[model samples]
Target: MTRITVLGGTGYAGRNIVRVAAERGHTVTAYSRNEPASPVEGVEYRTGDVQDPEVIRAAVTGTDVVVSAVSPRGELEGTGKLRGIERRVAEEAARAGVRFGVVGGAGSLFVSEGGPRVADTPEFPDAIKPEAAELAAVLEDLQSSAAELDWFYVSPAGGFGEWAPGEATGTYRTGGDVLLVDESGESQISGADFADAVVSEIEHSEHRRERFTVAY
Candidate 1:
């Protein structure tokens, strides 16, 4: 079983990942600003703010993988603040010699080959622009990280998270930078299935230091 540490373990995405990882028999640790109301069984939970690097670094120490699922929304909304946060995590991952996998946003993905990022589209909703823009930079930094970092960024299908939590079908389609869509042209994946894809990559690095997306 792999020892994995999940930052933002209490958030919508992090909770699902923690649950799926634990169910798969991986040694999982959930770290967040506060303990979960109902912690997943067989998973260790650590309470601390991600704003503090020491707390995150200590969590990264002695772990095979670090899953960064931190959300830059709500109280920390609409800011390009996660760049520093992700850099700090990258720093610790490099120091501890652990593989890093992050649950990235869909905004950074290209709508076309050259450089038409999703965030650049006129139709892209204004509500999520801040979070998307912030996390997009996080993905950019990961892509250009040092060769020995052993990191990967996985962006979920557009209809992800608590607002549109779909049921797990135990199936998902994976693709690179360009968004993945079903025959119906809907870009979505269940939270559980998204976690499954992330863990599958963690077990075997398919897109090392690169970004991939998942959809139905």
Candidate 2:
């Protein structure tokens, strides 16, 4: 079984991933600012700030994979904190020769020819823009970094997260940068299904060193 450390394990997406990973019999260490209110069984919970590399490194030690689900709230100024944290995690994962996976935003995903990113679209909420931009920047940096890190940036389907909770059908579609939509022209997936995609990636090496998205 793979030993996985999930940063931001208490958040919505992170918690789902942790639960699914644990259920799959993978050992999980859930690192967050606070313990989960209802911690998943079989998960080892640890409390710490996401920006601390030493803490992250300690948590990552001996782990087979590092899944960064850390969310950068928009109120936080600049991308320094988020970038620093991701860079450090990538660096440490490289040093430890471990695989890395990131929960990236759909902001960087293209919608159409010459159209703006999902985050830049008028339909996208303004409240999430800052965090989306920060995530995009971090992905860009990770792509350009010198470290030979085998990192996968997993972007959710459009209308993802708590705001758009699609029903879990135990089946979903995966795509690269292009958006995936159902026959109804809707792009979404349940939290559990998204977690399923992440765990599938963990088990299989598809989308290595690149980004992929999930949808109904």
What are the models' TM-scores?
A: 0.95, 0.93
Write candidate 1's Cα lDDT for 1-216 as tens digits: 999999999888899899999999999999988889989999999998777878877888989999999878765564666778889889889878999888889888887578688878998898878888889888878878888798999999888879898998999999999888788878898889998999899888898888999989
Consecutive 10-residue window with the lowest summed lDDT within model 2: 72-81
Clashing residue pairs in candidate 2 (N, C-alpha, C atoms within 3 angstroms): none
**Model 2 ranges off by over 4 Å:** 74-77, 113-115
* CA lDDT of every candidate: 0.87, 0.86
Give the per-residue Cα lDDT of candidate 2 at 35.
74
Question: CA RMSD for every model?
Answer: 1.3, 1.7
